[model samples]
Each structure stands twice: as structure tokens, then as C-alpha cells.
Target: MAAPSPTDHKNRKLLGRLSLPESRFIADALRAETVGGVLLLVAAIAALLWANIPAISDSYASVRSFHIGPASLGLDLSLQHWAADGLLAVFFFVAGIELKRELVAGDLRDPRAAALPVIAALCGMAAPALVYALVNVAGDGSMDGWAVPTATDIAFALAVLAVIGTSLPSALRAFLLTLAVVDDLFAILIIAVFFTSEIDFLALGGALVGLALFWFLLRRGVRGWYIYVPLALAVWGLMYNSGVHATIAGVAMGLMLRCTRREGERTSPGEHIEHLVRPVSAGLAVPLFALFSAGVSLSDEAIAQVFTRPETLGVVLGLVVGKAVGIFGGTWLAARFTKAELNEDLAWPDVLAVATLAGIGFTVSLLIGELAFAGDATLADEVKAAVLFGSLIAAVIACVLLKLRDRRYRALTEAEERDEDRDGIPDIYEEGNPEYHLRMAKIYEDRAAEHRRRAQKAAAAALQSAAGSTTEADRPA
Candidate 1:
């Protein structure tokens, strides 16, 4: 077999180990996403219930249809429009920040590290879109909804992973996160390109100028919500009036933020801003969007139409089958052609499980459904039911697969913890021997103590020098 070259070894392992800092960041992000996912699920349930109940369904529809906001600026919109346009902008802003950070500093910064997920994300998107298009090819005017199934709801997917994949390798989580992030970026692009009606160049120019000012101020180290909030609103409104999706404005602003930290800084301005805004996006903005957007009548007729309507059926099939096939197949093809190999800790089944989990296309799917069928309320409602149904089916199936994998991993972990040597500690921890760690720990501790002592001595010498200089000056030199 022509003695395997060192290059072969180097090329091995797709979704390879992450750096400690990157791992920590992923962990923190997953935690936040898990919470957000729960809130999203709750909000979705509330919406469905509110819309379906016989007594208050009318009230639910009326409330969502209620219009408020100043009309002069073209800001007057229904509650649902506000949720989809205004609030979802916050969600997209957070996504944009995440995408920016990933490209600038996270795993996606390295082409080698990024190649697999990027490919998977693109394929994942293409597959569902293809599936949707194929199903709706015969149906007149149904092609517009192809993008509806292309998105994977990161929050919902991560939430499911958190609940069921507790023992799965971190590489799986990292892969899913990166894949979803890329998926979100593409979804935004599709919205920008396909869903736009007509451009009011004047409004678009004003939005561009506002974005430039915002970027310029940040570059100049200008800060303060008081200064930026109104600017952001103006940009959003202008973008809305410009006939482009207003959420794009949020993304533009987020991308313009500096993602790398400066010297002596704990976090970059982008990170700080994300930290401040993420909770709002997750807890309020997304949940509210879901509450407004996911409220479809799940009557027998609506549920039946999800299967019978060509566009709705395409959405369901595209999300449920196409997502899994695309992500898993794309990953396999990439690994086969490229030098990359799957991580040893993960098997094909694990990949399949993650791929299935990616099929939970809830939030963004609902948003796109609304956009795609803006003039047809009935068709849009059917698409909503289709998204909910497809996502639910995907989640249930993924849960089963993940639970089995998690159990296997738990068993393996327990086996590794066995005290084979009859020692007080587990075999895995003691494999490297505690004595070696103790020595290393001692060396680092001594080095830290030495560094502190030097700092103190340097401070004392500086004080003495200052005191001598003052004394000399007082002597009338």
C-alpha cells in the first residue's frame, strides 16, 4: 500500500478537535441556544393553542392583524409584520454577529477547518431547495417557496441535542453549530436575492449611507445606545421602505462591527454587543416572532392540506427527508473526495443523527413561508402547518437516534471509568499518571509565584526611584 505518507496522517480527521477557547465558546453558545430553544418551543405551542381554540381564535387573529406604528415613515405594520420584520431583525443581527465572529476568529476562519461544514451547509440548503422545487415543479406559482425549507433552526436543533445527546462527542456539536451558522448565512442571502419585490433606490441609498455612518462611528470608537439606537431604527425603516427585507439591515450592521479584540481588552466590541443583545434576541425577539408567525390553524383541513398541497407537501418532505439526505450525503462525499476523515469518536450513525436534527426548520422556515405567500393567507397558513409538522417529525426521529447513541456513549464512558488497576482513581484519569500532572502543576504554580514576586519588586523599585527623584528636586537642584 505504498507506505502511507505523513501527509496522509495530517489530512485525517474531519471535524477534528477544537482549541480549548473555541471549545469553551461553543459550550457557552450551546447553553444559550438550549435555553432559547425551550422558549421558542413554548412560544410556538402557545401560538398554536391560541390560534386553534374555538373561543379565542378570532381574538388571536385580530391581535396578530392589529396595526400600529407611525405611518409617515412607512412603519405602520401589523403585529405579525412587526414580529417578522422588526423583531426578527434582532434575531438576524445576533446571527450576523455569530457569523462575523466565526469568520473572523472561530473555527470557520481556517479554510481547512471550515471546508466540511461549509460544504455540508451548502449541500444541505441545495438539497431541500431542490426537493421543494421538484415537488412543486408542476404546480403553478409554487416555485417561489423553495427557500422555505432551506433553513435549519439553530436554537431548536441545539435544544434537542442538549436534551438527548448529553454523552455524544463535542465534535458533533461543533459540526452542527458551524453547519447551522453557515445555513443561516445562506438563508439570509436567499431572502435578500429572491424575496425582494422592487428597490426604491432612494431609500436604499439612504440606508447605505446610514450603514456607512454606523460603521464609521464604530470605527471611530463611538459608543452609546442613545446615539446608535435611532440610527439603527432609521436604517431598518429605510431598508424596509427600500423594498428589501429589513432584517438585512441588521445583518449589515452586525457584519460591520469589529469582531477582534484590541490590546488590553477583555472582549471585542462585537462580542460585548452580542452578549448584551443575545438574551434579548433569544428570550424576547425570537420567541415573540415564533408566537406571531407559528400560529396556524391546525384544524383537520389545515393538517390535511399540509400533505395534499403541493407547496406545503414540498416543504414537509424537503425539511424531513431532503435535509438529512443532503447533509449526510454531502458530508460523506466531501470526506471521500477530500483527504478528510470522520472523527474517530463519531460514527456514521452519529452523523446521521445530527443530520436528522438539522431538519428542524422552524423559525426561518415560518418566516420564509410568510414571505413566499404574502398575498395568499390560506396558502401561507398551510405552509406554517407544514413547517411545524415537518419539524416535529424530524425532531422525534432524531431524538430516538440520539438517545440510542447517547446510551452507547454513556456505557463507553462508564467502562473507561473502571478501576482496572484497583487504584483509588479511575483508569482513564490515571492512564497518564497523576504524578506527571502534579509535577507540571507544581512547575506552573512556581512560575506564577516567581512572576508575582518580580512584579512586586519592580513596583517597589519604581517607588524608590520616584521618592529619590522628589528628594533631589526638593534639594533645589
Candidate 2:
């Protein structure tokens, strides 16, 4: 055989670069998010079961009443309620962080790249609301739940994707995730505005002042949360009292950090401060929020009530059916409008499957349901039922559709790639062609890494579709 051609050498190098080393950090992160999600699910189910057991009712009451908080705040909350209120705020902050990342560098970065997901997300939101409202238009006030099924749970969705493995084209998975992230941005906006109560002008003013100061500090090149952290707390308190949700503050807090120079002459004080607080938000705040908010007293008695409860039914149906129509239909319409383009790497079947998967709105759905009906105990109960009910349905739908879609799509895509490179120096992987393997490995590794980061950021945001009072900030006026 003639000496390996230059093209062959090129292919080997590329493949080598593409191969992924199993970094402990990545593996740990995957476990952190995956296990964390699973734990929340289990804890929630356990709570629901335990609360209903006659012997555990009193114990459940005790559990709910148990308080948790940092001593410094001179505060401790009723365990159950605190989970909904206090710990959730940190969850919101993390949501904001993830949202910021998406807008800056991830799925939402390029308008063209973002089109399919954006459209799908919008469709997901509108279709669910319309369908829910149409189903419950009796002026019975069940309309409050129009927002219920519109959210997607990012972590849970990704977990589903993991199970499906190489069956689904990576591109489709990414597109669906990006769509979910954008949908979450809208959901956050809706909660801050529509679901909120009356506002306190003074508190609103303080939030504005905080915003102004934050902008000024950014302009002045201040990156430290020194002045900002306290302001965030004050904003949260004010917003909480202002009739606006508090968690909006988390994003407001992050907005300042987003302004930090991507590439500075040196370092950023404020950005560093924000970074230090991030783990607090992620590790402590979010977990606590999950434990607290995920609880539902799923007694048989409650089960009977859910069928008659609009909020409960609305949430359940919306998540299951609404999400499917909205996400799938919207993506189809958008792609058709945009030159029939999906992700360059994905096909329509793949898109639909991923959209189905996007319907699994667990974490975010739970969080928002709590916020949307916070003060009303009866309503909160109904909302809880809806959340659990809707999320359960959505998860099932996602798992089934994704399983089927990926299987067909992956095989088709692989065959097409093969046809594209049937000649000598064939596709990225040909046994006996070391160069090709190296090149293929590099492409897969680089693209996959970048793609994953964006998807994860979007995913992190998507998980907060249910992010309600778990943060502090003035909702936009």
C-alpha cells in the first residue's frame, strides 16, 4: 500500500482529538445532577406515602414543622413551608445562573441556531395554556392553572435522554433542550408578573434602586457581591412583601455578574463574589428547596379531591398533552418556516421524539405550582396534586416517544453518513484506518463537549420552569 495519504493523516489526528477522556469532574457532575434529581423524586414519593399513612400523619406534621435555616438570619421556618419559600430562593438563583449562561454562550447564543428550540418552547407554552383554558373555561377560576403544564424539567428530561443513549441523534436532544430553556425564561417572566400579588411601591422602588446601583457598579467595574449580596437580600425581602415573587431577585443579582468582562485586563471582584456564592445556591439552596417543595400529602382522601380540582387536573393534563402538542407542533412550524431546517444534525422524527421527552416537566413544574398557589392552603394542595399528576404523565410520554424516535433516527443518520462517504477515505470510522478513527474521535469529542455544555446550561434553566418563590428579586414591571 502507498504511504498513507496526507488526508488520511489529517483524519487520524482529528479522530484522536475527538475521543473523550472520562474526566472525573464530568462523571461526578452527571451523578450529582442525576442522583440529585432521583433523590428528590424518591423523597417526594416517600413524603406523599408517609403523609397518608395513619401512623405517620402526626409524624408527617412534625416533619413539616421542623425548621431549618442559618442562625445568622435570626430565622427558622416551618420545615415544609420553608422548603417552598426560603430554600427555593436559592433554587431560583441557580436557575438565573443557568439562564444567564444559556443566553450568553449556550443554546440561545445564535439566533439561527436557536430558532427551532425557541419556536418549540413558545409553542409549548401557548398550546398548553390555550388547551387548559379551553378545557376549564367555566369561569370556575381554574383558569389560574393555564400556566401549569407549560414547563419542562431539564434534569429529568436529560436523564431520559441518557437512558435512550445513542438511539436519538445528539442534535435532536440538543434542539429539544434549547427549546425547554427558552420556555423556562418565559415561564419565569409569567410567574413574576401574572402569578404575583399586589406590589409594594416602596419595595418596588427599592428593587429598582438596587437595579440602578447594580448597573452603576457594573459600569464602575465593581464585581464583588459585597454591596450586592446585602442588596439581594433586601430586594428579596422587599419583593416578597411587594407582592412580586422573591426569586426574581436571583436573576437580577446575576444580571450584574453577566455584565462582568468575559476577558478582562485582569480579574473581576464582583464576578468572583458571585462565583463564590454559586455553590451555596447550587449545593445547599436548591437541594433544600427540592426536599421541602417536593412533599405532597397524597392520601386517598386527596386522590378523590384531585379529579374535582381544576388546578390539579389542569396541571396534569397540561403537562402531559399540552407539552406534547406545543413542543412538537411549535418546532415543526418553526422549522417549516425556517427553510425546513431542524438542527443540521437532526431530522423531524428525532425532533418530535425529543419534544415528547421535553414534556417531562418534573422539577420546574413542582416549584412553580407551589408559587402559583402559595398562600391558599387548599389551592396549594390542589397545585401539588396537579404537579405530581402532570409530571408523572409527562414523564411517561417522554420516555416512550424518545425510546422509539431515537432508535429509528440514529440508524437512519448513520446510514446517510455512510452513503456520503462511500468512496475511498470513507466516513470517520473505518477499521484498519487509524487516521480516520483519530479524526472522527476529535470531531465527536469537540462538538460533543461544546454541545453538552450548552445543553446542560439550558437544561439547568429548564429544570426551574417550576421555579417560584425560591429566589429573591423584583419581577420586571
Candidate 3:
């Protein structure tokens, strides 16, 4: 047989890798997102701390001023805001694309599945803004920070779940994720509408035209990332100049990209594009933004500043108090008044704990704060102070609450593990393992198959009992 072509060889290699079990791959992806997000957060906090120190603060201002864009093209921007505003737009844009995908083809498509999160998210947004306004005694001028608490940081929140262990149920985990995705959509919208300044109509028109051309190419079955990248940059530059918040560029570009992974429509290299760009978006795009935006000028009086200003108080209160009230209370009210129901396995306390964790608003809050108080240094600094304080408080409170809950529920698992120890099997699966470790995980799976069969039988008998009861009641009536 002839040797496979280079492209074919690559495809075969990809297929072989994919044949390495999907669950393991997904688990690894989650692990990476979790660990990486935490690491970036740590770096961001360090930058903030270092930037605030007496002498070190002076060095940061200089470090951030180094320009990287084309001096020849006269497009140079401050490297500080460039990473945060310019590149992080790619992150938001990728986020927007994912949001679109979820709405069109993923969990958000089903009315039953989407309804709860959508409604809860709306309440989640509205309640927090109202709460924030009430606390800040906000007027139109100071009201610019209203949307600060509206986001749900997925990786950070999910990391809390991972730490909580068995205190949370799988259903609760699923609910929070879906709800957060919805929350992200709302936050993006708030950014687009509220944070945008003024528009350059001609430039915007040109960007729209570029977007149209991109869509046309996508429709024509173009599968090249090269086509999308230049156009995407054009879109960002135009939007940046047009006062539309440049990160919206990623959204438009993603809408132009095709995700035709189903049967017999021409396959696009969207995944390949992502394989190239996601690292750039994740490793560089988000982290760089965090590094720049997270540099808060903290003094010895940083702690005291928390309750001093209205904007600072608004941010801190909105996230710590507003998030818990909005997410959990909204969720509870939805379940009570509407036809929505809580996940079967999730306790109300766990739900509340997860919602508290959702208040960990580090990334999007910083992004919005940057936009809202663009030129107002004092306001921006206050906002950053609030964000750091709120995020830290929420993270600590959520972790402690979930830890207590986990300890309460861990008795059975602890007992079972002890039994296993007596029987001489090693406790190798303490926290988690690498993807390779799961290749030999068939024994537990085989036992699960038998358990599932028994479960099906039990469900059948329960269903029959309910049906017979219904029949008897109808006959008597």
C-alpha cells in the first residue's frame, strides 16, 4: 500500500489520539483549565501586590508603558492596556463563539434545559445591580459600575467545586455551569451596550463589511484560519477605533467561522484553528490581561479603602452579598414559582455554596471595570480595590462553607475507603490522576454496568407502582 500523504498521516495521528477515550481527555482539559486559571490568578494577585509597594509601584508604571505595535504604521499602543483590552478581546470573542454554539447546538437550545438558567441569569443580573445601586446610592455618574457583579467566572467557580469534593452533586455542578454560561452571555451584553463609548461610523461600516466578507467565505466552505485571522484583526482594529469595544471583534469572527462537524457537510478546520489559537487566547490572551488589569495600587490603607467610597463599596457589596442573593435566591424563587426543579441530588446548601463561589468575579469584573472607568484613574483604582476585596472574600467564604459541607457528607466515603484499605487495595485515587492512568479503568466500569442493570429494574417497578396508583384513583373518582 502507498504511504499516507502528509495531511492524511496527520489525520490518522489525530484519530489515533482521539481513540484514547473521550472522558479522560475531558477530565484532562478540566484539570488544565482549573490549574492554569488558578496559576494566572496567583500571578495577577502578585502583580497587584508588587505594583502597590512603595518603590516597586514606580517600576510597574514604566514596565507597562513599553509599546509593542507598529511604529511604522503609527499604531503603537501602551503595552499595559494592550494586553488587557486589545488581546483579551480574543478571549471574549472566543467566549462569544462558545456562547453562540451553546445557544444554537448545545444545552441552551432545549427550552426545558435553557429556561431555568436563562431566567435565573436574568434575575441574577437584575437583582445584583439593584442591590449594588442600593448600597452605593448610585446615580447615573457612579452607576457605571452597575454591571460589576453580573459575571460568573467558570474556571474559578468550578475549581471551588473540585475542592468541595462530595459536598456538591453532579447535577448541581451541571446547573452552575449552565447558569454561568448564561451569566457570561449577560455580562458580554452589558459590556457591549453599557461600557461602549462613542462610535466612528465609517470605520464601523468598514468592519461590518469585513465581517460580511468573512461570513461569505465561511459559507463558501473556506476552512483556513489564515483567512479568519487577518479579517479578525481588521474587525478588532475597526471596533477599537469605532468605540464598540474591540473584543467584540472575536465575536464577529467566530460567527464567520464554521462548526460543521456533523455528517457529510464539508469539514472545516475549526478545531485545528482552535488548536493553534486557544493557547494564544488562553496562555497569552487572558493571562496578559490579568497581569495588566490586576495591577492595583494598594497602600498600607488598602484594607481601610474597602468601605470608604461608594464605588468601592458597590463592587465589594455587589459581589459578596449580591451574588449570593441573586444567584441562589433567584434560583430558589424560580423553582418555587415556576415549573423548574432543583437537581435531584443537589442539596439547597450546596446550591447556595456554589452560588457564593460564583461571586468569585476576577476576570470579567476587571474587564468591565477597566472599560467603565477608562480615563478616571481614581474611579478605576477604587473599582480594582473592590474587585480584589470582593473576589478574595467570596473565594475564601465559599471554600470554607463547601469544606464544611464536604466534611459532613464524607463519612460514607471515608468508611468505604477504610474498608478498601483493610482488604489491601492501595489508595491510589486520592485527589485525581493523569489521563494515562485511566486506560486500565475497566474493572470499576464493568461493576457499574451490573449496577446500572439493577437500577433499571428498580426504576421499572417504581414506575409501575405509580401507574397502578393513578389507575386506582381514576376508577374510584
TM-scores of the candidates are 0.85, 0.71, 0.76
Tens digit of lDDT per residue, candidate 3, span 43-100? 6877787687787887887878777787553358888768866887777766665565
| Model 3 misplaced stretches (Cα beyond 4 Å) | 1-29, 71-74, 138-141, 159-168, 264-272, 407-477
Per-residue lDDT tens digits for candidate 2, residues 51-130, read 66787667776777787765454345577656655566666665665456556544355455555567778888888787
Best by TM-score: 1
* Predicted structure 3: lDDT: 0.67
Q: Model 2: how far is 387 from its true place, Å?
A: 1.5
Error of 2 at 99 (Å): 2.7
Estimate candidate 1's alpha-carbon lDDT, on a 0 to 1 scale. 0.85
Clashing pairs for model 1 are none
Worst 10 residues of 3 by lDDT: 1-10
* Candidate 2's TM-score: 0.71
Candidate 2 stretches greater than 4 Å from native: 1-35, 65-77, 138-141, 160-168, 223-228, 259-282, 342-347, 405-477
Better of 1 and 3 by TM-score: 1
Q: Distance (Å) between predicted and true CA of 18, model 2?
A: 14
